[model samples]
Target: MRTAALLGAILLIILGLAQGDSDALGDDQPMFDVRKVEIAGELKYSDPNALQQYYDQLLGSGLFDDSMGNLTNFVTRPPWIESAKVRRVWPHTIRVSVVEHRPLAYWNAGQIITAEGQIITPRRLPDLPLTKLMGPRDTESVVLDQFSLISQMLSTSSLRVAKLELEDRGAWNIQFSNGIRVALGRTDILDRLGRFVAVYKSDLSGRIERISSVDARYPHGVAVKWKLQE
Candidate 1:
């Protein structure tokens, strides 16, 4: 009877040890099984549904592991989102916050320029009322920079550039809102622009109706193209 009691006690101890190991393994399980995911952002151009669906589907890929690097990379994959912040809310939730890019100018078929002159082609392009900028290949930043500087210089002037074009041959053409086009050759663009601005403010301000175009290729002065009367 004493031997039987001892064996029974040993079996009880073994069972208790097995149960404790099982509970410890359960404690190491995946952070409550990812019950919910939350994504928030000030989206001026992105579709909320698309973002939600994409992130929700990513749950199966183990993105719910609450890894900061994985979450950040997934959020920044969208073209409109310039940057993102990711966090794990603990227990069963993941959160992502994002910032959208501010469109500076219209670029090409589907691309747009940012204030920093970076080119981005988003998944969906929204129709924004902005000045059009066109240039040769790999000249997005150059054209954007020139547009910014010229726009600043013309802020006090009456004419506003509606379209700025840069050709492969290094020529520039600016069409103002008042239907006046200006041709600035490759070399000495800013100097020629300064000379033309002076001319517009002092001499051609009143006679704008009769002017058709302005050529600032001359070294010292600009050549005004006049609309001849019939």
Candidate 2:
């Protein structure tokens, strides 16, 4: 009984000494307090000042008390941030490295889609000349893939895709840079695109400005809608 009691007392004394050491460090070492934060990254859309505000709570905190994982998660909470890393620098500085998502095109309803098919909705959309792609819910990757294919198909031609839409019924529509719209119904989309390209090069390229819309759903040929005499 006496031996167990002595061991318990020794354990309490050891714990008390550890607590005292921690308290002493906190009180006597102002150099251990977080004094500066460094963020390094290529930020095209995200503001560095705004990102620094996330670490404001860590300021004046003892370097030992700050959690690196929590700091990293907070910096990566923004939609534009793809990944982030946080580390303590010596006695008083916290350093963070961040990677941001690169936008590929404008998605439905003011959202931006990245090359890897990530949809991000920032508070304010950026004004870029990128093509617009639209589709039903949960079909972002599908629409982006189709758009890429179509863009590649039309790469040799002078027509640039301004916008592409995949309707709920699976029909595809494309709007060209010159304000001409094309309808490719649910079937044989590539064949319709091919026919349009042939007809455009053979018959429509010279007077493209007068053409309003084209229906490429037919297998044999495409029907062109010309602008009014006005």
Candidate 3:
């Protein structure tokens, strides 16, 4: 018991000395210059050169003392970054971790939209062959919601959508990966697609090369246009 008590007392004394050292160099005691900075995250679309330059200028700023406000603001402002966390490695090093936006589909032409309907226009589009979704700027949520529903419905098929468009007149159209276009008109879009799918499972998919377009505006049947065979 005596030895244990002595060891406990020594540990407490050591901890106190360490705490004093921390107090001498803590955030409030003295502001230190950033000598090293590490960025940790799976970043693909964000430019690494721009990131390096950004950090260089930021660390050079004497005003970047201990507050994470500057770093967080700077990192999150980039279109690809969803959120960022900043931490100090005690003396001269700062670490930044970031979460990126997941691009669900391409919007308009150059813009990409997240699954949550947030639009981002990166400097360069990713090389991914994403499905395109188009609609008025005000109808992003509506269009995105419909795209999710349509994509989920098509997931059961052997094929996938290449593009989806919603015109000002509320007409909907989808182009499948096999380059077959389907006009869904205004209402009952998925129901129309289901009708078309029945034909596809029974007939069309095997003859995809001969099919150019499908008009599903009929309540009971769909119209198919065949390609000219040479």
Candidate 4:
């Protein structure tokens, strides 16, 4: 009876070990599991659904091999997406965190184009209110570069530029907050602009009620137009 009882106990231990091994193998398999997803930083313009769709496509491609390097590359490729992190939670939901892009201005296709000469679409409009910059379609970079110089000049003079447009012939037309247009010719921009500033400071600082426009293209001085009474 003792011998039979000992044999029974040994058999039970072997069976238990086999069951444990099977459970471990099951745990080793990759299961669709995500617990928590966190997103941060400038998400006002980003669509959550679009980001999720991108994530789904990547995961479906089987590119993420549960490795850190592959996962890092997957998240940072897009220009708009700043960063992304994915985590597995429990059963079948992947938690994804993402950072979005910020736009500087609304590039109007009719007036201004992007650096790539692609017509700036309304969909790419930025939330931030920036100065409108207009130029020929293929000359956006040149116009943008000039605008930066004009902006600096205005800053020094404590003036604000509402709109800056580049003419087809390469001249510049700028508007100020006070509803005045400044015609700056293609050449000698800085010198002509300096003359206008000197006139504003010495002659027309506060005496003029309104200024319709200022023509700064002439060699000797600037011609000012007074606003008509309403």
| Candidate 1 lDDT | 0.81
Q: What would the per-residue lDDT of candidate 2 be over residues 1-230, giving only the tens digit for each residue? A: 99999999989986776566685455555536777888888988886677787666678877777477777777678888888888889767988788999899999998999866899987788888889999999999988988888888998999899999999999999999988899999888888999999999999989978998999999799999999987
Name every residue pair that clashes in candidate 1: none
Candidate 1 structure quality by residue, lDDT tens digits, 19-127:
6656533554542445566888788887888877777754533335547786788778877778888877654567778888889888877888987677888787788
Best by TM-score: 2
Higher-TM-score candidate among 1 and 4?
Answer: 1
Best first by lDDT, ranked? 2, 3, 1, 4
Give per-residue CA lDDT, model 3, range 1-230, as digits (tens): 99999999989986776576674455543344566778889987888777766766656333356467767887688888888998877556778798889988999979999866799999899988899999977788888889889888888888688899999989999998889999999999989999999899998878888898999999998999998989
TM-score between candidate 3 and the true structure: 0.80
Among these predicted structures, which one has the highest lDDT?
Answer: 2
Return the lDDT, model 3, position 217.
Answer: 93
- The Cα error of candidate 1 at residue 210, in Å, is 4.0
Rank list by TM-score: 2, 3, 1, 4
Per-model TM against the reference: 0.76, 0.81, 0.80, 0.63
- Backbone clashes in candidate 1 total 0
lDDT agreement of model 2 with the native: 0.85
Model 4 ranges with Cα > 4 A deviation: 1-40, 53-99, 110-124, 207-209
Across 46-130, the per-residue lDDT of candidate 4 in tens digits comes to 5656655555654432223467566657765554565677655433444556665444433444222433433434334445556
